[model samples]
Target: MSRQMCERPDCGRGPIDEQGFCDVCDRPPLPAPPRPVPRDGAAVRDGAAEPERTVRAGARVGVAHVRPDPWYGLGLVDADQAPDVPVISSDPVAEAHRFCPDPSCRQPVGRGHGGGPGRTAGFCPHCGTRFDFDRPDGLTIAGRYDVARVVGSGAYGAAYLAHDRNLATQVVLKALHRSVAKTARHERDVLVGLRHDSIVRILGYEPEGPHLVLEYVPGEPLSARDGDRLETLLAHGVRVLQALDYLHARGLLHCDVKPLNIIRFREEGPAGALDRVRLIDFGAVRSHTKDTGPVVAYTRAYAPPETDPEHLRPTPGFDLFGLGMTLREVCRSRWTDPATPGVDSLRLLLDRATDPERPWWRFVSARQFAEQLSGVIRQVVAAAPTCRQVTRPSALFGSMPEPLHGGLGAARPLAHWVAARADESGLLDILAPFSSPEPGDVAAALPAPLSDPDDPGVTGPAGGALAESRLALRRRDAVSAAERLTAAALPDWHWLSDWYRGLVALADGRPERAAEVLNQVRRALPGELIPPLALGLCAELCGDGEVARAHYRMVFDTTPALGAGGFGLARVLLLAGERAKAVEVAEQLAEEFRYEREARVAAVRLRVVVLPGRARPAPTGEDVDRARAALPGLDVDEAAAASLRAEIQYAEFLRTRDRLKLSDAVRALGPHAATEREYVALVDLANRLRPPLGRGRQGRRGRTGRSRFGAASGRLSS
Candidate 1:
């Protein structure tokens, strides 16, 4: 009931589709306003003009169309002509801005549903529903927030753009209707305590006036934004999930999530092209742990299908559905053009996240949603023409570690078992989500294959052989994957085939061959992004850090959303002795792009080790400890950690019984201690601390015991 019904007289189109596109024109549906009453005993069509435009939030949209013709295709306006209405002001919300509550009877009753601006307060002449936004305009009830302008009105309350006398900045004053005032206080309590970039901050609240003040963001509602690109739309989607995750973590839910409640950073995306999405309107917010019954404040377009009165106590999955719906509409605005690529991948993500029946299995929570979207964004960015100049860090990578890819990397992948080990999700799925992470291997790490093959069908130019190669790689048979690709019929598919072949060659320890194959792919598909990434791999393996840095930068510069590209660039920067740039790139990868864990470790290394900009002696005990501390998560340089532990123990022994602690020192050194130079240092320290053999004393209590076990650190430093 949130949208007015299309008045084609015979057509069954709702005013807005799930994507906020008009069913008739594919344009964004106009805001619904009140319809003028019919005259002469004839049923007049409600609105005959501007049917696809949005009216004021509570204004009744006239629906007078009399069986209009059906049209299909993308709906769009001039890029420069989209309306930019900054929401919030002191003046009462315009009569044209308010819509009737009736879903079927959308008739305007305010000052000028027909001629002049309607009165500030009145009953709908056509539907007889009373509406008001006049109360909070002049009253300074809280004494600090001067309710200067009425920006908007809704079922819960009237919102006024106000001035904070103390802070001298703009803020929104929500003067809630007494019926929902308690909910307003709950919302204030929820928001005032939290601070997140993607969520609006609650400044203060006044109990007497039953109103709350929230920070004013200078942007238009997403409903007003049109023609924005799909990347920006996806960014907004990630931010929304992050906000929801933050809320769910605190046991609260913003049950009434919709496009109208989101603020686009500006008319268009930020210069960096990252969507700085801020969620507002927390009226239906309440504790997920506490059952509050069916909530009245929800928009049908983005509301989950499970809002049954008995089951209205919101769940994290429920809110996740709402967010999915909201993102769909935002994304659909730019997907009108059939020529636009990446829509299929994005729609698949949307479909998965909003799967009313089975969302939780794949995206059980916001964190999962963020992670999957991270994969989706990588594809979209790689497919994109170019990335924004600046991009935000990804949240998905926040938990991963700085992958230890050694220079000229330990010949091929260590072993099948080593290649098979993974924590969660695909382990070596660096650049192959779209190419398809060889499920066979990543899944090998798991007890079995993905229980529910969420793997998508190939919609890109690449086809079956590409998938086969990926499977082969996961099976640790890069030679066969390479051989099969070499003989495969890749006519126009040459670039795509070679791109994968280059990866296979690199996996097989043929960096020179990988470089040759990638070079061919580059010329064949100069605009193709995969070549840059593949070439970077070859370059790094060839010991040309500068060339690797350049290629990786090319990939990341063209698409910041691709984690592999950004991660590669961060790694290259670190290797190239560009500490500052490496730290910046690492932060961006971790924070905005979802490469969370790896970036954190890389940043730490840049500070404690890599950034010193000069070769130093072996890592001191403290230095090794710093490195050890940075990689706290599973799947890391275990050898480094082992050596550091041995050193710590040996140092402790130096300060205590040298010979007595020898056995424990040996335990700490781990195996392969003699192989790594760092571990060997610990052996020398242990040897120096050993009780000197007494040539004169025929039986130095432990001298004979120590001789049989000098250093005794063999098994500790693997």
Candidate 2:
């Protein structure tokens, strides 16, 4: 077959089949003649002198382009068709210095080591050009950028709208005032080296008479204009998060992200104009080093208490806290009633929004902050990392039988259903896994209930009444429950009693104590699977992966059958880094229990194992049909049935869309409706499935400080 011609100019060689290029031009296959070299020797080859053509091409393609640039490489394009060379401007250093802003410098206002005030001042003595400061209007330092207009100003310095005469493009210049120019320039030098889609682009900087001329961003700040409301806020927040996600992925932190710092491009729309937001401003950005000091510029209300002196330490958690707070503001702006309290007031209110007795008061932790905000700001805030227990799958939310609540006088519809079916025998059989055995077991459980019933008394064991009263105390407030649970007697008092004790410890911010008590219960009652499951939970809360995995394994191994409960356990195990074992257990459970909840959770986890990092996968048409067919025979309550249907439908969508993996699809179940345990399990599963990819995401790594889980457990068990 005849070979194709190279696409480059000035070459006529046949295309190399493998590279799709000609030997001379090395251009991809094309049907045109190559352009000839200019007759004038003065004509530059690639925007450089004739001799420098090779150098310019080398620079454009990177260091490997030097020498004959080994034809070892494949296809190439014409010089003109090649990617544009990265523009490299003059170095700010080796230039002259201007009068120092500090009083100690003593040079005259407009005079310095450099010829002109603008040029000298822009160039720092220690560092070179102050890229962080605005350039002087009249001076042409490097003959590339020309100062146009001042865009805005803030704590850092003035931002300017400028034109790059050479590049023929408009850009925004952010520069510190003369006083902060030196330090700001130093910071800019470091920041400009980073490349991310979300971050502002850094062109180049020049010293121009006591000032620094820097590259300019062309978009408007998000704070500009009005009209756009909820959608605008959400879009802006999403973009900011995406940027933050990118920065975090690159190991950089944009510590100064805020509404004002974000830029928006105005595009004409049907009614008016719409703003597209993009994150800008990196003067305060850092490389996220281990030695990061207390961050100072973080806004007070948005900043979590951990950034406070009492909790002075900066972690990715710090950035997450800010992100959560920003999300709350955005969501509240849309969701909250305007009459009750506006978004601004809510922020102020939360500043003093103390419930010292409540477990949530300790918002010093980022996880706690994220959880609290997630509750109120449903749409914007990502799931809370700490409230994992509150969102588990097997949680006792609406799943409990109706009449059962009549025992506690809390709404008995579920208990009544249980009672109506109580004589059915089949109903009891269906609930056998969840119920305790023997009349004595029921009687022992009854004493704590019959005692005070309402106010079982206090935490101490004066009698059965006291134990009931102590449990009652938890309903009042986290502190009251914590106090009571801490005083309660030893093991075997009640299964739920121990469970609640663990919860009390968790609520009290004592995760270690909660883990201890929960672990003890797990050890004592291997047959009672809840305790071991809960023990795994406590270990998870304390960020102890090994311990959590062990406890979960115990539950999986000891449980007689794999059903929704066991499937849930397997899901958690899979999340905790035991994918192989999780898959094994999940496969077993899928064979026996075809319950929608179990199957969905198992399927989702399996997908995670199959394709990690992708979004939650949708169940296939076959999976949906299978789930639908099984639904009629499933013994789940009506409400649960409805939920199961929804989940199945979602799984089908995942299968069709092919966006997420199985584990992600399973995690898409969201939080449990009522049971804190199920909610926690869900959170733990999500964590395990996809360990936080970057700074703002959640993870279980290198946990050295006081455990937030430990504190939460202490509060619960206390």
Candidate 3:
């Protein structure tokens, strides 16, 4: 057989492969020379009767499918101010004070002997250890980085700000101390494989100097600035958590996550100014698989108490604990506002992230920590009265179908129209406005906890059992729910199991017991809003208004997207005689498109709702007018709309004694009555409220009596 030649005429060395490429040249066969085109520009057919080519190579085509990232900044802060990049330190060589690199003896090595300038390189007098404080000022490192100055130094390494000759940008050159010089390769291995926006970028490492080249973040350490929003601080925490989660996913731990390691800066982009944070300093990063042994390096205050320097086995939790402490310290500088909306949730979040008692119970993953931290940010943003944000669905709970309106969102009862009383003046007194919904109703209405997909229970019999328990509770079969949960044989520490127990207690009308059980779940999942929301409902059912208010406010203020939480909060606020505040909450709830109609109607009713025994004042004329004005645009059914009209008219009658208007409004509701009794009651209410006829000259002398709606007979107007 003849050997196939290379595609190129001059490079015919070996046989061409099936891919039409010569093995020697490693080059694909060149494209066939362009075919000659006919003058008519129609067809170019080969003698073999080849098919016509329809799809040409490199043809301009249809729209390309591009999937852009959906995430932007968290929007918790107004990051519109562009911050100036901090200037790099000058005179770095002279500024880098001489010190022994030996871990055992880090004493001063090159200090002046007789009030003169210190030497740059020398041996430590204490341990006879060689030390080099030589500044790389003008010298190029690894033939690429032009040394600038020493920015930071520690026992393990010293960071130098250097300009990259190749990249034409500044970078950090971290040179490890001689004692831990080998760690540079370990850090480079961890960093080179990672790519996340929040994490620092790694360049090539120089083994000779044992230096790790990193992206230089031109900003200060993560901190609270003057006029900074609390959410801003928490947002930084969330970003750091994201980086940590990315690292943990790859079986790596950033064992030294602290404020100093996270750099916060401002970037100006095409869209606008943006506040950004980057996690840096991977010198202490280590593999999770080989975490056992003496800790190489870590800040004492940020590390967990259990982390002994002599024998430390670090987990992902080690980084999370450090982040928790970092945020705690930074936030302390401006954490004076106890009344801030998400402050309690923030405390709960940090507590869970750094739980001292149960080391295993602390945040199990960075993703888990981010979920709760993000929830807290929502709460903080939602606390503003004028702020209306899009509702974010809870990650840990299913949607709550119930509005839990507590009667404010519903129409007046049939009894309110039929059982009304009229005075001698032909004025009808309707039933007092509805109070709170039954606690049993609120309990059943609360959102159900969603089981974590990654949980071991999800793939076990307990998962199926938990679902069955939820179904049983929904059917009001408390007994079945309890039995299924008991049969599941879940571990005692399983939060989902306790969650079901709480639901069962609620189903059984034992809110006090439910509260106790749910509180345990809260401790287990402290960052979750679902637990607090469930607890709020339980407290409300138990009539512990104070506790309910706290819980409801926490969840609602965090994110009004949870309609149940908002409605529940509004209900208790009204019950507590905070009529104005309750109305405000309902109005805010109306801002959410999903709950707009219900929330709007609730706001109208709350303004006129009469807590008969409470100290709340009766609805004023302005309140009645407002309710009437809001009724026309309300997207409710005929019956609901008529009922709302009648409610407003009744309030108007109380304010201005407009009997004619009240009677007409009441009569308008007749067609919507579900039963004959209800219709008749509505008629009676209208008739009783209707004005009597004027008395004739001869009829004035005749005897008069009260109308049928009146308690007793009285003189008639006719």
- lDDT (tens digit, per residue) of candidate 2 on 29-126: 33222223342322244555343122222121001111221110011111111111123232232222323434334242333345543443344454
Q: Against the correct fold, how does model 3 do in TM-score?
A: 0.75
lDDT of 1 by residue, 518-602 (tens): 7765543332345556667667667778887877776565455555666567666655656567657766666643456555655
TM-scores, one per candidate: 0.41, 0.35, 0.75
Give me the displacement of residue 392 in model 1, in angstroms: 16
Q: Rank the candidates by lDDT, best first.
A: 3, 1, 2
Candidate 1 runs further than 4 Å off: 1-139, 223-227, 266-275, 292-296, 307-313, 337-340, 359-362, 387-718
lDDT against the true structure, per candidate, is 0.51, 0.40, 0.69
Cα lDDT tens digits for candidate 3, 1-718 = 6655655676676665432334565343344445544432222547332211211211111110111111212555566644667775543343233556554555656666677878776667789876555554565666788877778774466788889988999898887645566677777887889999899999878764567888888887887777677777877887788788778878888878888888888777887867789998877778888676656678878888754322267778889889989989888865577777777667777887776766756776776677667666766776664253545444455456577776677777666776777776755565656655554565456655444533544325554465466556656878997998897787666666677788888888888999888897887665567788888888888788999899988877667877778888998888887878988999988988878988998998887766656376778877777887887888888888877887777667677776777767877776676666666666666666666656223333324333344433222223
lDDT of candidate 1 vs native? 0.51
Candidate 1 least-lDDT 10 residues: 69-78
Which candidate has the highest TM-score of all?
3
Candidate 3: where is the Cα deviation over 4 Å? 1-79, 88-108, 111-147, 163-169, 207-209, 266-274, 291-296, 307-313, 384-388, 419-432, 520-529, 553-559, 576-597, 634-646, 657-718
What clash count goes with each model? 67, 94, 2
Regions more than 4 Å wrong, model 2: 1-141, 177-182, 209-218, 223-232, 245-253, 266-276, 286-307, 310-312, 317-718
Residue 57, candidate 3: alpha-carbon lDDT: 16
